[model samples]
Target: MKYVRKLPATDRQLSNQLIENGWKKIKEPRNFSLAVLFSLPFSYLLGSIILWLAYLLKPTLFEFLISDVLSISFSIDFKMLLYILFVFVYMLIHELIHAVFIPNFTKSKKIFFGLNGLFGFVFTTEPIKKERFLVISIMPFFLLSLVPVFLLNLLGFLNWYTLGLCLINAVGSCVDFLNMFLIAFQVKSGHTIINNGFETYYYPMQNIT
Candidate 1:
């Protein structure tokens, strides 16, 4: 994969060409305004689920979040500095998890990671199958958000860094969660999904025209 300083603009021409090639567009927020509107529910629901399961597995995390993270007095120390740095690094790691699952990423050289405005994202022109794409969309949620919390809770260490990773990534991965649901409900199995910049498309594996 590659990295760019700034992601390129949405390639409408490429989107148009994909349409001409008979690939169909998948559902996506038409604009950032609608994105915000639609993403809130997903973020809330996913965050709730993560927190619910987190405390269920180990009640200490919930207690700590409520009693410590919420009530702790303001301070600037090593852990605080680490948390600050972690917040920035989390975005990169999140996208990297996405890039790793992207089919043929290691070989394709089409995948890229970078900032687009305020968000760090991974982009690729490769066509990915529905089953595989579903994994790609949601893997980061598990690996970055849930796994850290679950593992730490299981091991009996509760710290702000892991919790911060857990909470922030839950909200940060709102779009991935949304896309997973959209693809699961809207697209048929055995099909492939691709995108032209921000415009996504899906086509049957047997009939990629």
Candidate 2:
């Protein structure tokens, strides 16, 4: 829930296990300028393209479906705002899952919340095994993104609010999707590392003395 001030004895044990398994710990950036520069544009561009395509191909369908389910009868702008709010809440929930799940195995828990330009993220500062890292990285997308999208689609009605919510969900999922790929594909390259806005760790292994 809070950033860890210091690594406790239990944290040391967890770190040890991670090191033995070739998992590495990374430091959070003091400034997020680079992360913002890299992630925000890409995420926005990709998000725009996807939304445009969805709008063009399924405008009538989306409208009908969202209208039926949300049923709020609000203006399109108001509905869009609510949808964005929902996305923010969903993102928070996704991060909370990471925080709650880690305590079961790790002694230390640290969370950083900040904006990288237009992109925002929550990440753990604690070191974890690769398996744990992978699980945490993927959990948000599966539970928060994929499931929500599927359910919303299944409901089969679109209104301004639901349409906005669906788009927000898609964007949120896209952020996680990119992160999952980085974690699954990229390995530690020297001391330089990237967080990938999910849970990917890019850093050198700390030598345990």
Candidate 2 Cα misplacement greater than 4 A, ranges: 3-31, 40-59, 62-85, 103-121, 157-160, 173-178, 188-209
Prediction 1 global C-alpha lDDT: 0.79
Local distance difference test, candidate 2: 0.50
Per-residue lDDT tens digits of candidate 2, residues 19-46? 5766554443223344434456546754
C-alpha RMSD by candidate, in order: 3.1, 8.6
Q: Give the Cα lDDT of each candidate.
A: 0.79, 0.50
Q: In candidate 1, what residue range of length 10 has the lowest lDDT sum?
A: 60-69
- Cα lDDT tens digits, model 1, 1-209, are 88887655578888788789888887788755576678899899878877777667767545655564465578999988887788878888889889988877787777888887767988887878888888888888899888887788778764655676788888888888777887898789989888666577888885431
Candidate 1 ranges beyond 4 A from true positions: 61-72, 207-209
- For every model shown, what is its TM-score relative to the native structure? 0.85, 0.51
Highest TM-score model number: 1
> Candidate 2 — which pairs collide?
64-158, 65-157, 65-158, 66-157, 66-158, 66-159, 67-158, 67-159, 193-202
